[model samples]
Target: MSDDPNRIKALGGGSLLIAWQLKDKNVLIVGGGEVASQRVESILTADAHITVLAPASGLHPRTKLFIELRGDRVTHRDRQFEGPSELDGMDMILTALDDNELSNAIVKMSRERRIPVNAADIPDLCDFYFGAQIRDGPLQIMISTNGNGPRMASIIKKRLQAGLSGLEGQAITKVGLLRNKLKQRAPGVGGLLGRERMKWMSQLCNQWEMEDFSSLDDSAMENVLDKGWERGKRVPKPSELGISRRSTTSKSFSTTSLLLPSIAFFTGAVTATLLLSYSGRR
Candidate 1:
């Protein structure tokens, strides 16, 4: 295990990103403020049927799909939301209420009902954390800090926005091109090799400094895949792809090498002390 404290702490944290398929699924949003407006767009990205519960009805353009329920009185009975029992079958729930107590209560209820929930700005009450996401054709880039600091996540996402502008469509097209070529080269074995190659190319593409993604050439991509495959076969997980066992062993040896000099100095000091004591006694 790595000695990084953030990595350990973030293990228990919610997913930094999610690819949800909410098409034809019911989704409920508790508040109709700007936050709710933003969440509505995200859910609608999956083509979900959404319902909003708020006192008055005013909506952003993106929230047009959802049906709105109005009223100030708490009409909920039987511990069930009165507006729609349809919401009970919803695969996901999002709450953006100003009332902390109400948000907390709804989050607790959602958990008991086994529905995934996201309470805006409240990581402790949420089952998932939504990150800054940018959609480019078939590729989706998600940047997150596990809710430790959303601002930092957003900043990184913006930086990525400029870096990854036209890369996604290009990458997907390249993958398709690569796969088709592989079908002729190795047939059944092509898919496995194609996937490994695709992964390497994607990583290299992401590291590009400029919006000009002309650097994703086939030869270079293949070299990375070949190296990655050799390295990957010896590792247990994909995250450890670039890490080398030899480098780690070398660092450990260096640490041990430093201690030898200290040990020799300490031994010399002790011997000198012993000689001085014997001469004084004589």
Candidate 2:
């Protein structure tokens, strides 16, 4: 909380604004190099339809969308950025171009059109900042120093990536199993009821270790749900889920607390049994 007016708030430092859920939405990227590719890969997990604007668009085999390679500076190619009309109607915009002017122009245009933009290396012109991430299956770990220190974010991300090595996918799968059990038990709780059930299920997941997946079974799920029901009437808020979406989208799980230990377990030293198994194979 500096009054210098030059500091952008880092992620997880008291108050932070984060947005998720860009699935099936249009995401425009104004560059096609490695930096831009990193941003594209980050959003691809959310199922966003990406449109890349570059002089020479490279192949993104995993991207199920269009890539237009204009000449230098985004000339005219198959479905190139025609104009604001092309840039308009996008859910989000990211600029990783080498030219500061182009990036600034894109940011300004996006702002005029009420679109959010994340400009690499330019925080003043950006509406948001991308963080370092660790992914295991559907589980995602995001660490941001806001725009304060990109190096710090990268360091933390690398540490987490090492610590949460294998457990990312396992933790997500375990939670899914628990959530499904809750959903089945309370099929009629559409709005508040269904969400509360999910909330309690998350609590259960937090209370138990990932290795003890048995603790997240049907009986445990029901017990957690019943306890929540006993608490009386309540409406859930967006902050509860860390990142909330519209009704059409599933609520994002707040893995901030849950992902740490799981990452450590997955990436840390293996257990004696695991070591024995590896030795035997060797």
lDDT of 2 by residue, 66-159 (tens): 2333122222223334567767678898888778987887787898889888888887887777787777776677787756787898988877
Candidate 1 regions with alpha-carbon error over 4 angstroms: 1-18, 55-86, 177-282
Q: How close is candidate 1 to the true structure, as a TM-score?
A: 0.53
Q: How far is candidate 1 from the true structure (C-alpha RMSD, Å)?
A: 14.2
In the range 52-159, model 1's lDDT, one tens digit per residue, is 766554444444333333212112111223433535776788888778887888887788889999999787888887878888766777787865687898889878
Model 2 CA deviation exceeding 4 Å by range: 1-17, 57-82, 162-165, 190-207, 214-282
lDDT scores of the candidates, listed in order: 0.62, 0.63
lDDT score for candidate 2 against the true structure: 0.63
- The number of the candidate with the highest TM-score is 2
